[model samples]
Target: MVADEKKIFGHPRGLPWLFFIEMWERLAFYTMLNVLLLYAKDFERGGLALPSGQANEIYGFYLAFVYFTPFVGGILADRMLGYRRSVLIGGLVMAGGLIAMSVPGTTFFYSGLVLLVLGNGLFKPNISVMVGNLYAAGDPKRDSGFNIFYMGINIGAFLASFLSSGIRNTYGWLMVFRVAGFGLILGVIILLLGWKVLAHADRQPEKDPNDAGFGAVAGKILMPALVVGVITYVIANKFIPDFAVTPATMGFIIGMIPVIIYFIRLPRTVSDKERPGMFALLPIYVAGGTFFMVLHLNGSAMTQWAADDTARDIAAPAAFQQDALPTYYKNAGEDVPRPAEANLVVVEDPAVVRMFGQKRMDEQTLAQITARYPELELRDFDPKAQATDFSGEEAALFQFATAIYADGKVEVVEEKDAHGVPSYSAKIPEREPALRRVAFMRKTPGGEVFPTYLVTQDSFDEIYSGYEARFGHPPEQLEPGKWLPVINPELFQSLNALFVVAFTPLIVLLFGWISARKNVTTAQKVFYGLCLTTVSLLLMALAGLASDGGAMRVSGWWLVGFYAIITAGELLISPMGLSLVTKLAPKRLVGLAMGGWFLATAFGNKFSGFFGGIQHMMSPVAFFLVLAGLAAAVAVFIRLLLPKLDAAIEGLS
Candidate 1:
């Protein structure tokens, strides 16, 4: 009976274990992500207090860097680390990064973020490779296997916000981050525990004893990269802090010149037999890169939209609130205001600066100022504390009176109501004056000191000018308390995953049933994926237009529909690409090829950021439509290349 139970599934019983591991790992990752956008946003809820445009910029760069690093991780695994060792190293590193984030300081926060980038680079692609390895070359269940794995990812993704939001709301953002880190470590240990069941998946390629180690080859790559990265980092920091991001990304893209040249030249130097497979993988890499650049916007551009533009409801239900103060505040609070004409800028002109300040405030510094605000729950502090000097990080610690504050008395607004609980709406009022000092650099006798300017957002027109060109509106201050009693904005993000988790199994089964009689080629799925992605963007554009170009906040339904449709595209292309890489890669280069695919994704993810950063430079509608057009072009290109792409897969056979 035990043997039959184990043998019940056609594939190895181990598939489910791997699926769960990935799902939880993704759950932790996405949970952190839900907070990431808000973290970048400068609100009372522990945000960095940057303009949405600027925050999105930073978010984009971080994501790009995060996805990009895996190329190195993949190479290290293939040559030196091996799948098991690489996965272990990456997972532990990622876990460490997540753990560090719990500390709640920039030093720790930035370091933790870096660790996440490195850890994800290590853990992400390697496991997918192992999944494909679980099946023999001609296994018919390969597609379904990936579908199951994708389901695992969406499940975790679906739940990440809940886990993150719950911990963050109950404790602080730090707790949620640490939770994600814990999740990564748990995933690694799970893989280790299941090692015996999954041993066949880790088989090494048949190769000469003299094959170069992945680490050694990467050292050849990273050594030069390290030198270049350090030199560029120094130069950029010294010479051009403002331009550092663009330059670094451009440099990373360009720094690959040596690596790209080496890879391109290596195929020529290698034996004729190795040539076809290597070249075939190149186009796949290109496709992977383009797809991700657009797809990964979920973390950056899309998140920005959800945070700043999309309308969300207070997670708590109306029936429960059943009171005026709560309902009135909900309608008039920040993030979502009641007066459409006032809340929505009926622009006299395109470039008017109503809510003018777009500058980002230092996290620790801003936290200090707000600490001086009158306690919403009725507590008092010295007015003198306002002038007290704080070394940024040191200042953030002063918020607790531990003496008067209740343990979790302040309810944090969420994007969704969890565990059937109605989401609440609370506006923790800030230190009322709304006046803050701004420091500027000045040439001093010794070296240089900074000067101060008190630029206040006193009116709608003043705040409006501060907004990035795209949004064409004033800052919240200009429309102060406009978002008071606000509905939970971040919740819309969860709606995307909810749809995915709810529908993925059905979609998979439906597709499987359809393919039963007539198999759907990988290329066909790719085509469908592109179509869905294109439509999703169009949906967004339509929503933007309906909002009358930021003249009003559109209904939340637009975002829901957009995500649902785009997620369908994700189901089609994302995992299929993973499965394809594993299926087509030569055994020896499997890790490396997988890494190459990740490299493409890294570039694409960065592209997502790049677009997000510059989005304010143009109208949101035009910006989205431009991408929609790009997707359509890709669809056309894929259809044209389908026969060749199909043949390549066959030739691989």
Candidate 2:
């Protein structure tokens, strides 16, 4: 398999082919993932506007299944389709899914998520197995090869942040999905072009009489798991109706029970020599499950932290500065200035204020909306009550009225049909001086004009309360020129990938240097990684404390520090664990073993969602501390198992 011995940076030539293919695939994967939660909960940006808990549940299940499918994909590739064909099939299917997601409809969006989960199952595991195949048995370069391959993943992930931000900012969310689909297409093209170079790494399907057939595994494993999951769902609904966790989550957890039993019984069926290796993987799976449970939070709870609790008021260079979204002021500190009170039109009705959170419509738009819904009620805004010379946080008290409008940028409250598909319609009451709220307009550098509105006190929920508690008076006011650029919350998702790219080389070198002097095993590295993960969560818990359990906004630097620490831990665990799987799994069972690795990841990812779904139930400090304690407990468990894990790969590496 290692023929044509040409090397790319002292590793097999196939490394580069796999590297670039994975790079582009991850770019597409992460580009969609980073914004899924935000888009789900967004109101103004053509998003689903689902509640945070529901969105977190969806995100978690998506991530869990995406990793879960690899188990089936791995078996199919190992026993039927070779790695190369599987990779191509996955790429094409995933591209179609991304394109589907770009289409406007909840049906298309969910259908696309299903496609993504299926595609990732086929794509994710086979490629890594191919990377392992490039090196002969017990080759020292294997670990380093995995390290280099991991960089490709992070490089794509690093770029995804900017690509998602730019495409989402300039075009919209749908366009972001469209662009990601095209990126996957490019990766498939690269794979096609490098087919000959990667040929040596593609092995024929195994023909082992001793191995269990895919059908046997599916019947004994998959079908029973599904039945158990359904039964769990039914029972939970019937009995634990008031359970803190969602029934679906409880079902998923319960379903994994049989799979866990299968894994526990697996070693008994293996040859005596291979039994220890099979047993060793169980602890390794535990370690992986624990680590990913925390690491995957980037898309859920952590993203929520960035969006809601963190201060993102970093000043952009003059060329990039523009009017921020109305939601930005909700958590913005007193340092960020409020628009002049004269700029706001005061609406007495609280219901009207809630309908248009911070929206403004011009006279023509208002006239069109009123004409379309003439049966709607009308309200008159007082003309002489304009408090022109106002300053301070008190100015947020002003609310503007508007008839419903949606010309791409404008938001109108949504309605759902009997079939549960969302359609836009709001009974926006007509107001006097139709253009009152549109008095202030901000123009983008591209010369596009959009109306901006100051946040009403009701809209500035936590910020208003925090200001009132801190300073019995409204804070000092600065005029328009002193404005700060509000960084999009989704862009912060990139920090983890950025830190991975930045830290990989240093980590690789340090690990090499350490191994040269001392016999530090892969198990020890995972143990240390879990310890660091615990520390990172503790750091975030402290930040939650500083913010008074999310009553105040903290600087974005806290997020920066969190990513830096956890990424260092990620490098130690993820790639090393992948390399360890290759070293320890029986040659015939490599694909299944890889699938098993991802199955553990699926469990971890599901729990990540479980925690995220429950996030709003607890204060920030308690939430972060609970995660920190879980990580610490896992680290201790891993520490107890290190000797056995180290022994499993003792001679192989």
Query: Which lDDT values do the candidates have, in the order given?
Result: 0.61, 0.76
What does candidate 2's lDDT look like per residue over 1-653, in tens digits?
A: 55447887788998988999999999999999988988876654446656566678899999999999998999999999989999999999999999999876678889999999999999999999999999888788888889889999999998897788766655557888998999999999999999988888888888578778999989999999999999999999899955777688889999988778878888788888888888888888888989999999988889889877888767653322224555555656767665433233233333233344423343445554346434333443333233232333222222223333344334455544223444342233333232243223434456543333433455554344555566575645435323345677777778999999899899989988988999788889899999999999999988888888776789889899999999999998999889888888887788888999999999999888878767767888899899999889989998998888877777444
lDDT of 1 by residue, 1-653 (tens): 01112422787576887887788788778878777766765333344444454555566667766766777776666665666666778778888888887764457777888888888887887888777877777777788788878878888887775676555444455677877877877888888888777665665534444444655556776567667766766677677855625556555665555555555554454456656656655656666666677767877777667655655444564211111111122112235322221232222221111111112233243344335322212123332332133433223222221111122322234322112222223222232222333322223345423221112233233334423233455324323112333344445667667777777788788887888888778867888888888999998988778766655556778888888888888778887888778766666767777777776776677678677766656577998999999888878878787777777677766
| Top-scoring candidate (TM-score) | 2
TM-score of each: 0.74, 0.85
Off by over 4 Å in 2: 2-4, 317-323, 340-457, 460-469, 475-484, 651-653
- The worst-scoring run of ten residues by lDDT in candidate 2 lies at 391-400
Question: In order, what is each prediction's RMSD in angstroms?
Answer: 11.7, 7.8
